[model samples]
Target: MAFFKSRDEKKSEEIYKIIMDTLKNRGNQVYDLKVEFQEGVVTLSGVCDSEATRKKAILCAELAEGVKKVNSDPLLLSEAAAQEQAAAVPPAAPVSPNPPIQTAPPAAPSVQTAPAAPVSESPLETGFPSAEAEAAELKPSPEPQPSPQAPETAARSAQPSEPVQPQAEMQTYTIKSGDTLSKIAKQFYGQANKYMVIFEANRDVIKDPDRIYPGQTIRIPPLP
Candidate 1:
């Protein structure tokens, strides 16, 4: 079956492509940058030499037309990349015999974001298969439709399309062995009895408070 991508889906894909192109085409950054767009949000994924380059790539994409916002993640670091980045960002400030270490202006410190820890074993380690994954995989992959390959392509590709929709936020949580409702409640909601909130929100998968297995994915709900 052809993967028939919806207009919005196609647009999102084109946004991703544009972001990738900008990052790679930039100031001699040769690595293939990756990108994803969801719900009016743009997420940049790839290896860059330094935090500065990653930030720059994100900013360039944000300026691209149809970009709601940029989410920089999977920002990888390698020593070689770091050296290349340092050389690129600050070109030897006037060769003073003793140049003071130029410091970034005082601003809100960037929030620390670490990549998700790799699972030592596959998802099958839990001995339970993913029902949601099974359902998703059953559908025929959509048809590849003609859409924007880049933001510039998209800008002139379509006329007066519907507003880009936002991406659904999928929250994930891992279960711990010997975990009980009260323990989960205490950790997630601050009250042992608050386990009911979690239990209620996840009744679709959680049969009982005592039955949750380690490595299970549970959905947490926002307070109403």
Candidate 2:
């Protein structure tokens, strides 16, 4: 079997270098950082001075051309650093008071007149006669019943159901006595240089692309 496992190892090394370079270029310290690569995903694990640094690391990984995803679940910010960040920000300025409103001068006063006597037949007070009679007349009528919601039901029924699309099928192969990633890629995707795709996908199980032995299962992603 043509064995060449260094393809995966070399790829991992290159990805690690790129991640480190990106972190450095973005002003992140990588002394405590650990980078892992698998199936097109980059995992960043480390302690950062602040959440912003952690986010910057993830952003740098995302900006890398071949990275499909960045996992920062293992990244953390120091509690003291978080508290210090909160304490360092200055408070907002106070609001200014509004100017006083100007007003017109007071008008001259007039003489007051005596109150008039109440009329027994006034509409508001006594026209309806007894209190019960007035209350009966003033009682509000029953509210109208709401219309049936057929339009809403019809609108819901008119909505089209989304079609279900099948997920892309992944292929797997058991290594033969004499097989290389390049041969497998050529066999599956009509290109040997594209072996990196297979190596990346199977990095979890295949430590070295050139060293896989017979009967070892390997994933073969669909041709891009």
Candidate 3:
């Protein structure tokens, strides 16, 4: 059983290599391509230049020996390809020009009557003093009361605060050929599945985990 398992593994590796070479040589334009083969099934994943290119990659995998099935569902189109497809769609027919708007003629200027002159009332007629005389009768406002003084308490000396420790500088790694986040995580943290540590740390640089390129610098955060 062990010998047969070894043979199967070897065959899978060979098929994987063949599919990768075919994609590159045929110019299928599949970026970040990953091929997995198991139990006579080959799965292709990556960003393709177009639907046609994605189909071509699947075909290449199907043509490889020992590949009973090709799964390309995980493949996706590049942003440029998606935009090209959107552009290809015919735009909605231009809306018919709107009819000229009809506006009412400007109204004639309204005539405003002049306000009637205010009638003056003498003190003898209304038996009330004039506003000026009333204002002079008002007494001066009382002076503001002095604010109460707060009781004093004994003063305490200010204690010196501890100096803040500097944060640990995050480590950085330059991507190399065949360097995947999972591999880098394993190298630094001893766990392949902790790739998210690197991904979350370098969100400014990495948009996709599988889309890293050679010579790109990424931050490696310290393990929590």
Candidate 4:
């Protein structure tokens, strides 16, 4: 018995044909090109001649009717193609293995030090009084005085100290495609129900919590 193709299968086949025809018309050479279609998503796998060709193939697949998304991660350039691209770029200049050595000039000759003369014998040993001893005998040392302590003010010590309150910290996040207030709240506060916190903080920019567009900057307030 012969089997018939289902409605979904036929639709997938049509999408695949459309993508293949588009790629062919664009003159993109993709070796071993394979197209997998499911639930409006197309996945491409194969070797391309170059990165530009691969991108073109993916763009063609995406532009096809009934194609919601295209996965081109499996599409890559062949080894030969990669080598050709590498050859097109010039190689960097080679660095020298050994640099030139800089020699310093000879240092000036060291000067010779003259020998010190012999010291004479002390006056105390020769039974004559020294000048320092005679001076000390003429004048006596004065007594040392103590430093005074600073007085503390009674009015300054009786004042009470006030407590310091911390300021609230906020962060700004640019809205990306498919981002919602609840999703942002879940990312920052780890709870989807805390989306109101963000909505209240971004009242100037975000008038409605459910309505947000890409590229709009919103403030994210810290949770209490």
Per-model TM-score, in order, reads 0.31, 0.32, 0.34, 0.36
lDDT tens string, model 4, 63-85?
A: 77788998888988999888988
Q: In model 1, what lDDT does residue 181 have?
A: 72
Candidate 4 backbone collisions, by pair: none
**Model 3 misplaced stretches (Cα beyond 4 Å):** 1-9, 89-224
In candidate 4, stretches whose alpha carbon ends up further than 4 angstroms from where it belongs are 87-224
* Preferred candidate (TM-score higher): 3 or 4: 4
**CA-lDDT, candidates in order:** 0.70, 0.77, 0.81, 0.81
Between prediction 1 and prediction 3, the one with superior lDDT is 3
RMSD of each: 62.6, 60.9, 57.5, 50.8
lDDT of 2 by residue, 1-224 (tens): 89675543555667667767766787866446777767778887877877667777778777766779888888776776668777888887988898788888787687787888786784566444797877888999899998777988979888986543322578889989989999988877767888999999999988987888888898988855
State the displacement of the C-alpha of residue 146, model 1, in Å, after optimal TM-score superposition.
99
For model 3, how does the per-residue alpha-carbon lDDT over 50-72 read when each residue is reduced to its tens digit? 87788777877888788798888
> Model 4, residue 90: what's the lDDT?
98
What is the Cα-based TM-score of model 4?
0.36
RMSD of 4: 50.8
Provide the lDDT at 45 for model 3.
Answer: 82
lDDT of 1 at 203: 90
Candidate order (TM-score): 4, 3, 2, 1
Rate residue 193 of model 3 by lDDT. 89
